[model samples]
Target chain A: MPTDKFQRWVNDLQKAQPVHPDQTKQTILSAMHPKRRKWPWIVSAIAVAMIIFGVSAATLPPVQEVLAKVPVIGKLFQSAELTIVANAGKLQGVNRTQSDNGVTIKLKSAYVQGRTIGVRGVVSGIDDHATTSGRNIVYHLASKSNHLHMNKASWNLQKDHAYTFELVGNVDHLASGRKIQVPLVFTKMFGKKINLRFNLELKAGKPVKVAFKGQTSVSGYRIKVLSAENFDGGIGSLRLRVTKPVNERDYLFGISNIHINGSQKDYGLGALGKHKSTKQSGIYEFQTVALPKKISSLTFNAEVADWSKPEIYALSELPNQLKVPNRAAMYQFQPASLHDNQLEFNFTLSGTTSSDRVLQNDDLPYLMYLQLADTKREHAIVDEYDTKGIGKNRIAPILYWVESSHHFMARVDLSETPFKDKTLDELELVVPSAFEKTRKLPTITIHNQK
Target chain B: MDDIILAMHGDLPALEHLLLENADYLERTAYLYLSNDTDVQDAISDTVLQAIRGIKKLQKPQFFKTWLTKILIRQCYRRYSKRRHDPILIEELPVVPVAGNELSSEQRLDLLAGLRQLNDANRQALLMHYFNGLSILEIAQITKLSPNTIKSQLLRGKQQLRDWLGDDYFAN
Candidate 1:
């Protein structure tokens, strides 16, 4: 542990230094001026106005373009994500509270044109009496400005999603019985698009976690099963959940949209990934009766609402690999005959588009090849009836099978316990087009159909 | 206010006592950062003057050394930036007579050669730890880095120092 090379190195540095014994105490003060002082505190008083009023430094004269040219310093500043401090006008004697320190820090944009603004932080120090202006709140309109780059170049919805923040911290001075207040106004750089459910983890500090199940709208909307004839559009709700990423923070909830189409419905804040409403990957469309409002926010263009199209198919994507059982638990489904006295709805990759459809397309196969990976089981293209409407034939239920390039068919099966199994984490489904002779195609779900 | 004025003018005995205790350390700190120059004294003197003027602003006086040293370090960086040099190498230049005292041989030979090779960040970390004697936590607060980052730098700096000083020279 005691290497002499290290010790000598430490020694050499100590030896090569000098001492300044004479220059110990110094008394220095800046030139006093009245107008020079009133600018900073005044801005802090109007921080809320500044942020909501949109008076930020957006107008800075092409900051990134001009700053990109300054040799070394320009490169540094340009490449940097700037988080410079702006002056928040003054707040004098506002009946200070313990948790209000971060809020008290005055904030403002650097300039009206958006560059070179000032930020002044006001901490009330004891034995410190500011020059008596006519008003008790002697606002520091101008602040000492410092430069920072924009939010990090890589910061975005994926990695770091930054949002505006208001922080307030106050703790009492134990010795003097005076309170120490720190009112900081700064933008927080969150790595993700403020996903309260996924990113806001409960670790140590207080963080707000929010999740919602429906869109946070003034009006509460509900999803109703409409008659197939009257089916109009999808309803949406924004669901959100908030968990403490830090310890002891409060939970929050917000809505995104309500009862959107299964595919159009965006996921809540609890889970991570590209869970947005606009994503069109896995939505199953159904008929919805029109509600009172005709904003058409609910109407999507690609929806197959013609009702006359005969090739009814439930479409979903299959991942490259299927997850097998790690450790099997509980009992298997005792082999039961699929249908009995009740009408059995067949699950198929290809099927007649409507119940009234008399002729099926010969170009497309009437059934699709279905396979189970865990048990090398293969079912032939057949007509299976589906009696359970709640049953999403995502894995085993063959909603519709493509028998050929154009012909469609449906499968009829009696058993329906696959989705109800508590042990299954994921199930796989494949629908191969008959004419392709190779590629298994995908199907889109048509809801509330016979 | 008058006492503050007295302290500022260096008329107060308290100033002298503080000098006797810490002037040597901060001077060496200034020389290390400012790099054995004439202005090193002035910069250190300014650091002291600034600290004295703002001592009331210091909530934790026990950490006065690190606190004042932080101010000195900032001044050093600012001055160095003003001079437009990135990692200023002081020993390559002719020596300027330090105003107060010379460095100890143990300090001079081992630390100077080792410290010159360090980048601004590592050298600052090393000096703040051994010279100004700041803890890892305090160092983190000043450097705005996590504790582990500081520890790794210290380890790397110490290793580099050993490699340069030759075997058995600094054996402890």
Candidate 2:
């Protein structure tokens, strides 16, 4: 029989089998029910007895102390390691509540560790419709002297009306053990604006800065570790310099699996600070997991990848498709036009092979470096601001998957680049590099000099 | 769709109705990944529990079936991965039902054996596309793969099935 016949046979088998079996439905329904049908009377009797006992137990100091010690932000730290850190930093005996327009926002606790400040709160009386809309409540933190730049915030509906929220971010400048008045602003809460202020004492352990000079070579690229710093929180920064290559093509360097004092935890290193490159060498800063108080050594794996040669395409070649060299992906460009000193176009990078991993939004920038260059060797690479969509009226490269087309839709803005003023006719599109095969170098360990 | 919206708002009856409506699809989809009847039932149960808990987080109401199938597939894969490490006795191997109306018991057994020979990704792609009548894009969404990958998997899966069963097993 043909495959279609097989499919039909399967379909027939599926149809012949009884759907909505009574046993399965009963099992699911019983699971869905709030209370079990079996032993209902016994469960209700036990619940009533517990309620009376709980009212009696609530007055006891021991029970009250145990209840108070229960972590309010326990759900925020799901991992055991993070839970330990959170419990150490958990604030005690602080409850600030602000209510307006039938909604209540209670500031439960806030802690400052290193440059990171975490705020946990509970929200109540929010509209259920708004919650079901799956839109986050827009909020931010403000202070007179310091600005709290929230990097991560999440809220979970604990019950019918209670929503637990946690916000963690790096503060611009926070003095250790300083009391600061922070006004939390909810710019949009289901079309309503609410603002609440709480007095928070910023207490963080002293930061330690260590200077060291060590060098390692990977794939001919010489890397020098300039310095390292550890703050109160297990967050630190590493500064490094890489000697520039004499060849026309450059190499993109990446570091991962950073270990401190031979710890198993991979203190993942992420690029920090602005990209600074000179003719001689390139300086890079990476955020790392801070070393413990008595740190001895640091180790990390380096990845080196040769950048693809710059491919200059004429403006007339718009609406063309090109296969990425040494990669299973296709780059398709739509028609390009200049708009008010900005070169705008929609392009898609789609996978061409089964094994090829589709590029996510975060991977788009690393896929290639785009630039607008003229006949003369002048070009402007996309800066950090352009990629982050920071400036007003600036359309930062918007990349989203188009379900209908089964490909990614990306709108990149070249408005703020140095080539913004250049006309499309005179300027050529330059793809400085598309990512290629990466080779991981052996882990380099650097011993600290006491 | 109305039931999905009501279910998202914590309507238990609406959620149960939706689950019952797609009960067979869920069971069959789970069975494709798991061979044991108990495992299939457990996968379905866990999928139902997760859906009931995370209904409000479901963004697209129209893709309820796809969302539920994705959950069921994950549960099935979890069990499948766990079962890989555990030792199984010869008697523990599932016996394929020999009674069928559209095909003889031998043919059904051969089909099941042939499908079992394919890799997990290819088999999933084939079953989701051909047996479940899901589009390539839908399969990609369910499996979190690119549509091109799904298409390639389906082609390779059909070829492999043909190689194992016979050249005429699949129509040109």
Candidate 3:
């Protein structure tokens, strides 16, 4: 009843402005008629054909050589319109103009960076003061059928009905020299739609050399640093293969203490996806914070926690006790309560001692798992949305709140665990170990195929 | 869902029908986020145009509602960012009292004023939950946050409102 009351209040508030369906429908239809009727499909087809042609042409040896020589300039050649203008040595002639219903839409310039295509152009039609109309001008990056829409750029209208628009869209993470189709549809209120198709070639930058590749183990967990690339924008993409099938939890805690060129940089638990062929391992994808300087021989470090080891405690050991020490801190754990397949624990972090020092620590450091006292099934503790007052989903099993600098209270709900209502075989407490190691990865060069 | 597919194929009537179906919803969502009448109207208009333009990319027709909601939210966020430097326009709205409802006009105003006082994240969580009647997971997907985060924000926001409206306001 209380919930219903809140619902009623919300419903009442929503009624503040009663929208007239017919009037709104009429307005939308009026805006759609001039634009949606004549164009879209044909333009998209032509654009696709152009992309095929452009892509085929880019693969030639001469083109690759040219692209290699002018990497910087190639980035500036974003759109087909711009590419033509660039090749012609006339940047000013890049503008492709189309006039329909007394308005002209011009494609002034475009360029592709990676898969992202950026377009800048102008729309000149209509009164200057009437530029900010209720009717929107939509720009489709691909085609109506393919449904690629680019919404990044804003159109700033100047005096005299002249509007400058910049649009950017991505072509599904394409590589350099690949070609993509972009269908630009300009629709204004009461004006016929203007469609322009462009087959854009991706500016290929030299692939960043993979400086390191090797297999290593940390805290009993096997991991392979498949490859690491140093790309523009100070970002580095690392491909990894870990012993365990990486889950969402791995994205938050799989990697830690990452340093590049012996200098520390901000890092997150990297994303791990299923290997194309096998589920036994996953492809770990993650990027490090902006590199401080050019990388020579880089060092990689992380705490790959092994939560598989189960520390069994009998019912007689009510309120089981466990302690695990990492490099800088000792983790003290005590089971507080267990019922209905739910478990709660009190964890205390003993600060660094003279013998060991942890560079830094996470506010919440432990990942959780559970097994029924009677069954062998082990269920990972996952972030539950049903629980109220949590703004973000907890992909990791560790549910905790800091009680003090060294004290934390944690809760685990086994309802969704693998064992669910089943009797537990044992309760396992998995915590990160303090053992630390840094691996100097060997560089592996990637040869570009001719 | 069918409407979205038809609209993508350049069916004007389907497009019109789809826009009409979500017209009230768009206005309410925009109004809640922008808290300005003019901005709400503008956002709704922009949402319609953008939705139609991008309809072909809707991928799955079943996701139409969520997709449309995401678009309107983007428009509302844009309007909010643009008006951030200006003082919140808490324009006086006439009370069209709901029949049989016990909440007084002053109380309603207090609730609205309290809403305006809350931060954007908290306010949005509450509005999405209550106004849109979306599940926590749905809200999380739209906001690109974890469901737990949405739940916590919702709880904190509800508490803040309860604090302002009196603890007994929702008491059974």
Give the poorly placed runs of model 1, Cα more than 4 Å off.
A1-450, B1-22, B36-39, B58-67, B77-107, B144-148, B167-172
> Per lDDT, what order, best first?
2, 3, 1
Model 1 captures what fraction of native contacts? 0.20
lDDT of 1 by residue, B105-154 (tens): 53354345435534445666666665556688877876668999888877
TM-score of chain A of each: 0.14, 0.51, 0.34
What DockQ number belongs to candidate 1?
0.08
Q: Residue by residue across A321-401, what tens digits does model 2's lDDT show?
A: 867767766678887776786555666666645423213212333343334443444322322222123222222333433
lDDT (10s digit) by residue, model 3, range A335-373: 456688665666665654433222122213223333335
Quote each prediction's TM-score.
0.25, 0.41, 0.29
Model 3 gets an lDDT of: 0.46
Quantify all predictions' global Cα lDDT against the true fold: 0.30, 0.55, 0.46
Which has the greatest TM-score?
2
Strongest candidate by lDDT: 2
* Candidate number that wins on lDDT, 1 or 2: 2
- Model 3 reproduces a share of the real contacts of 0.12
- Of models 1 and 3, which has the larger lDDT? 3
